[model samples]
Target: MKDNRYSLTGYHKETNEELWLWDDLPELDMEIGYKVGALLHYEQSPFQEISMIETKAFGRMLVLDGTPQVTAKDGFIYNEMITHVAMATHPKPTKVAMIGGGDCGPAREALKYKDVQQIDVVEIDPRVIEVCRTWMTQETDYDRDGRIHTVIKDGYKWIQEQKNQYDVLLVDRSDPYGPAISLYKRPFYQYVYDSLTDDGIAVFQSGSPYYNSDILKKTIGSVKKLFPIVHTYLCSIPSFPGGIWSFTIASKKWDPLKADLNGLQWQEAKYITPEVFRASFILPGYIRSKLEEK
Candidate 1:
């Protein structure tokens, strides 16, 4: 029953039609596969290997370093959860800075608020943006929106040069690996702290609690040391390893639980609603135990 035409990394060297792509999670000794209709694009950028594949289930998918980053169908779940939770929690977020959201999902969600004046998207790999623009136009075609300023630079380096600048800081980068490893450390969290306004808020995609508990623990633990208030929230993203994913929100003053949605204009959002936002922070008993673990 083994399929010789599909490799763990990519389509087999022998054939191209009806291929399978697997995201290998070595930590858990598991891998997830998608039935690909076609390998739309593939290339080795200066930073990493980027690919766009047409999947039978998810429509189109953006893969980085042989892992699926986002898909055309359920990508809104991650993007909306990450962006809206913090944006809604804050009183009035005008200036925002997003690190490593090259696919522009978080940026697109952030743009829905009329109060947001500017958004700076710092991505290390230009090809991520390029590939997303070309193949995933529905998600990445917001470049024409004047409020967004795409900065092709390293996020860790870029944030270090700023001070008291952004009202909201969104760390939407990849998992802790390669160039992004630094972004999940204490020093980078300090930089995030410094880059935010007095009452600013910051949020990070901390990965799945079931599989990536250490990452969630580290993100919450690290940010807790710096910010007066920190909370871990969960959302469901069908394309991710575990359908359930975690996000950490850190604040200088505002309480995310006390988010005011009466005046906010976000009717366009498909995933996040008032009830869902309130319920997202209500972690399960095991997750609470996971956060409490040493």
Candidate 2:
């Protein structure tokens, strides 16, 4: 392994347990460390380094390029919030397009809706899906459901080819870096705007409000220029850096705040309820002030 700060190294010496340390927010001089009970799998894929490790705290975790992507314990919070908010907001989301959710967490939640007929998952790296399927057995079995069509291609290019097709578009990508950098920019967002139906709604996982305010602002700002209705929401995920994560929902016709989520039913969803949906959009003063910045 490379001798970088992000590398998964040996024992911590103090506790004598293997440690997987990630310097995700190096600019802030903050790092998150996990006690690794076992290293399940580690390899270099065509796009990035992938690792599956069992941690004492978070159970099985999927790490990508040294950053923790998802953990078995609290991943439901993220998956449920990202999927259900937009799903319930739109009246009938029949066709869906998901970009960068190779772990199938968002896919799993989206599939729970009976109105959803098909989902096109465009993932840049095939290895991410392969590795997650092998180790993250708790995730959705994509093979069992014919509604999911997996396309191993760059999300930026794949989205450009689509137009007025999907009823809902889910951008479940990582932070703006590496292969995902383009996904956060304006050109890619324009493609996302174009790919949606007239009444379509799109949801993106904007990063932490406390740490990634600039990113959240930029993402919402860009999408606001394209869509008539844009609103930002919040969810708490224990695995994330700031504990509080933001998601932006942009719609062509419907207002998410006025969404009649009373009829929507998903027994499998753990974090999101109709009441939770209403409260998620109620952003704090600090976050409102950040978005208001010039």
Candidate 3:
């Protein structure tokens, strides 16, 4: 294949190439990939293959199946953005629910807020949590946080039992494939709508628009039917395959782009400022045009 910007996979074996190429997926001919320094831990769980690696540039990384999920160097960008955007928009968010954030990045970030009292993180795989706790404990301290409640179960089934309970609901799923496929559909979003309070806010990681526009488009469309205000935001994480990744925010009452973002601060956040939050909603011409199309 032509090693273009959209090249899906790249890794060097124990040869002189000096790097290992990891694909976001092996089936997709044009999905993006990354180079890692060395594999730290690899295991085949009952759910999926879990791997941890010491990246050459992005620091330590947590991989699910064959794709990159979280990285130590810049994981703050994704986790911080996902939590703060919704947390700041709501006037007083006390209860939060997270689905598929097995790495605990979202839970740890959410606990940093003063108003947040309890955070319920529902992850399907116990292995992802165990591996991250063992290898990436410094980056995420979800287990020690008294405000977090970790539950291992199917996210789709878990949300159906909750109704109008959470002030903010975050879906930090891996990808729109496998078990996460249902999370991208409208019914699950309807459940998400019912799972949040009247003025609740929710955000989920839509895949990279540059490489996976279809998922982003589908997510926006599905979320629009349930929420009055829906906005898509972007962040650039070096560990992820595409240079740009996206998050779609669905608000029942407030507009995230217009949320009062004055004087908001995060303890260890590296990215995500009021200026960056505003700019993230302003999508590029090609991506915006594609999203606007019928």
RMSD of each: 2.2, 2.5, 3.9
What are the per-residue Cα lDDT tens digits for candidate 1 across 1-294? 225744335544334444677777777888777777788888888888888988877889998877898999988888899899888888889999899889898898888887999999999999999899888856434967899999999999999998999999999978898888999888999999999999999999898899879999989889999999999999988888779999999999999888777644458888888888889989999989978877
TM-score of each: 0.94, 0.93, 0.89
How would the candidate models be sorted by TM-score, starting from the highest?
A: 1, 2, 3
Report lDDT (CA) for all predictions: 0.86, 0.85, 0.81
Candidate 1 regions with alpha-carbon error over 4 angstroms? 1-8, 13-17, 139-141
lDDT of 3 by residue, 1-294 (tens): 323322212333534544564463455555454566677888889988888888767778887766777888888888888888888888788999999888788888788778889999899999988899888855436656788888899999999999999999999987877988888777898899999999999998888898789899999988988889999998888766667989999999988767787635554677877788788888899999988888
Instruction: Give every collision pair in model 2.
Output: none
**1 or 3, which is superior by TM-score?**
1
Error of 3 at 30 (Å): 4.6
* Highest lDDT model number: 1
- Weakest ten-residue segment in model 1 by summed lDDT: 5-14
Arranged by lDDT, best first:
1, 2, 3
Q: Can you list the residue pairs that collide in candidate 3? A: 8-31, 10-21, 11-20, 11-21, 12-19, 12-20, 12-21
Q: Judged by lDDT relative to the true structure, which candidate is superior, 1 or 2?
A: 1
